[model samples]
Target: MKTVCCCTVLLLLVLIPTCCHGGNILVFPTEGSHWINMEILLKALHSRGHNVTIARASKTWYIKDNPLYYKTFIVPVEQSLVDGDFLKKMFSVFIKLEQGTLTLTSFFQMAIGLLDKKLNIYNSVSSFVPALLDNVELMRKLNETKFDLVLTDPCWGNGAILAKYMNLPLVYNVRWLMPEEAHFAIAPSPLSYIPMTGSGLTDKMTFFQRVKNIILYLMTAIQSTFASKFVYQPLCEKYLGPDCDFNQIQNDADIWLMRTDFVFDYPRPTMPNVVYMGGFHCKPPEPLPDDMEEFVQSSGEHGVIIMSISTFVNELPEDLADGIAAAFAKLPQKVIWSFRGPKPSTLGNNTLLTEWMPQKDLVGHPKVKLFVSQGGTNGVQEALCHGVPVVGFPLVYDQYDNLLRLQEKGGAKILTLRAVDTDDGFLKAMQEVLNEPSYRQNMQRLSRLHRDQPMKPIDTALFWIEYVIRHKGAAHLKAQSNRMPWYVYHSVDVVLFLTGAVMLTLLATVMFIRCLWKSVCRRKVKLE
Candidate 1:
């Protein structure tokens, strides 16, 4: 009887927390690198005994059905948001933009061409919400699930729409919310210091740099307005009623699980609900595969250099590839290049080219000396987490900005894509990073700072996730500014109101003094 009682107590201790805290979480994630970040968070949620269900498009490129981690709520659509050849074409445009090789007229023409295709892709992605809503059976099933919250990446506007439609408390695994960075939407971003994405300016800026930042900020606002009005507004009006604002719906999310921290990002104003979990996906190095370990061991004292340009861009222009290969040929360090193309003619004996690589494992490896990359957020953060300095050739999107942060921190050396193809630029950048002790020292310092947090970033993220579930929603933490109109949020109305009040007071005093002077003059005339 005593043994059975003890066993029952132990079982209750283990089972009680799971029973109390475990909640149903519905995830609507973005594709590509964003999905990779979401997957890590989902796994952590699953391990904590939460039930995770993913509502993914039938034509999604990256998301796969995995019964162990989450159940799938697949929504079939006519078109895939991303197609195989789409990335190749997009890569070409990015390379051209980075190279600055096009004439002014040609650049605009090329940009317009790419913009049209991009809009089409956006249209395809936008179709997801309507398709889901029209599906009576799927809607019925999702309704019956009794999910506690909807976890989504607000990069795709449809997720926010779905959450609002479902009437579930929403949480975002966010970095970008469409037309601008997530911070621009939720936090106070002053153009004087907080660098806008693609500005390529740091927090500390010159007078002219601030002017440029303001211009970019305006451009981003215009773009955001355009996207909202054209892409999301009509959908919101048709489905959720005319008063439903897409931007407001996104802003009303219960929690913003920002995928960046001050370690990688500049210090800026953020909201209470915005939790930083920058390197949450990063973990200590696991052992490499036997073949990879053998090759890494062969590098010996000189160490290894690993290069990956991320999911897209399998091949570079022939000349650019040749230049990179030639540079690696001169390096004493062994190289592992994650590539998928016809091998470059100038490829070196020291370099190993594979279609794919274990990027996190290689980054964590003790023998890995340098990370040569395209400056994707995941790759850069992984390099930082492992204390590996970087040589970057930033292609497009936030890649340049991501590398700029590391360069400002003295942990990275960046070479423009065009620059790398010329005048030994690629080789020089590589050698400088490899030889510089400060680069490694600074990165290791950052690693220490990133690791010194009281709770692990993943744990912090999970806590906030479950915190929102337990509380039903984190509405108290959300700033009222999110719901306010633009004039009210910026205090423009208050400024105008105060200005008018002062003007009226001054006018009244002036009139009274004039009247008093007139009376005094009249009395003086009578006395005379």
Candidate 2:
């Protein structure tokens, strides 16, 4: 009896921790920066005694260096093509189209959206489909290893499908402002018609701006619907199985983690399962290099501007480089530019060029007055977190939207690509952002609001991850409205239409009866 009791007690102790405490988590990120951010979240989880693993594309070099931190598994795919120059060129073209520069023919747009439903079937079918298939196979293999939950980048909807196939709960983590498709899927934003990040604040808009906004929204929706039908559906079906419904898969996600803060975005309704986990990437401050510190300090009363386009602008044109150099030459304050290749001879004595610099350290420096950036979400968040002003030159994707939000909030100035070609324009924009104290003060106020949230983003992410694992799938948290048909979900609209039809039919019937009675009465009177 004593031996049996001891055995039972030991069993309960082990089972309680396994069942109630932690479970294996698998993270799939679209790129290296995403993987790096996930690593930070995983470390936070690990500190709280949770087991985590990362299943990433082999192309991520950051993972190779930090083996000790994560149990890393590389999915089999051509890592070379993932970040190569060819992909960059394709991205550039995509951005141009997104910016309304390249005219999308109506026929081509319709074909890509509805019937072709495999995403540029002629072009991407040979290249991208194979890569997706290969990654799916790798995911299948990884599933055999047993994971309790899957965390996926919202951009990679295929990962959500894989999580469904594995019968594991999924958490969608968005690294940027949610695109319209993603916004609809996990957390339905109130401003469904608009492609812009947040609700449309039309109070400040002129009549012309309102009209333009509406037109832009309609075009964006039409184009996005077709793109998803083609590109997203094929990739999802190939992995999740032929029977899987792509629309349903998105709604089935257990939770959504947004890399955005209320400080930066317009207010909108959100669900409990949807969380805003912005600034998760901000970490402990590191000391700036002695030379860089000295350079900033040597500027005396004049403050320095830190300029970098991030990794996306690796092969900028010589003309662009010359324009940038010309702008820096005119600035009275010192400039530190992060350029990949050889320094341009046109750079003036006031400029310093390096292949790389510690970005966060530089942003946090006391003498660093302003930041001129490509306006990547992470870059903007970091600048805001440190209370630095910005001059945003957005290139692609959500960068433009972020820039608009920053500009609206008075924390930054937007310098369009058209302006970047000229020296005077770029110089003037930089000078305005740097010299103005309002930009810095507004950003600092926003930073405080972002930081004073109830919980750190990393902690919020980990809590939901563990919650899903403990519950075996947090189906309770998913919106029941997701399961309803489109007609049924919009029942109020349906009711209004039905009521109008009924009223019209009743009026018609009454008119017909009165006409019949009048004809009979007329015949009787004539007979009399």
Q: Report lDDT (CA) for all predictions.
A: 0.90, 0.70
Off by over 4 Å in 1: 100-106
Instruction: Check candidate 2 and list the clashing pairs.
Output: 113-226, 117-230, 118-230, 119-230, 119-231
**Regions more than 4 Å wrong, model 2:** 1-20, 58-65, 78-83, 90-144, 175-181, 187-224, 231-243, 420-423, 508-516, 519-528
C-alpha TM-score for every candidate: 0.97, 0.81
Clashing pairs in 1: none
Q: Write the per-residue lDDT of candidate 2 for residues 237-298, one digit (tens) a residue.
A: 66666766666776678877788867876665666678778887776568878998888788
Report the C-alpha lDDT of model 1 over 348-439, residue by residue, as the tens digit. Answer: 99999999899999999999999999999999999999999999988888999999999999999998888877788889988898898999
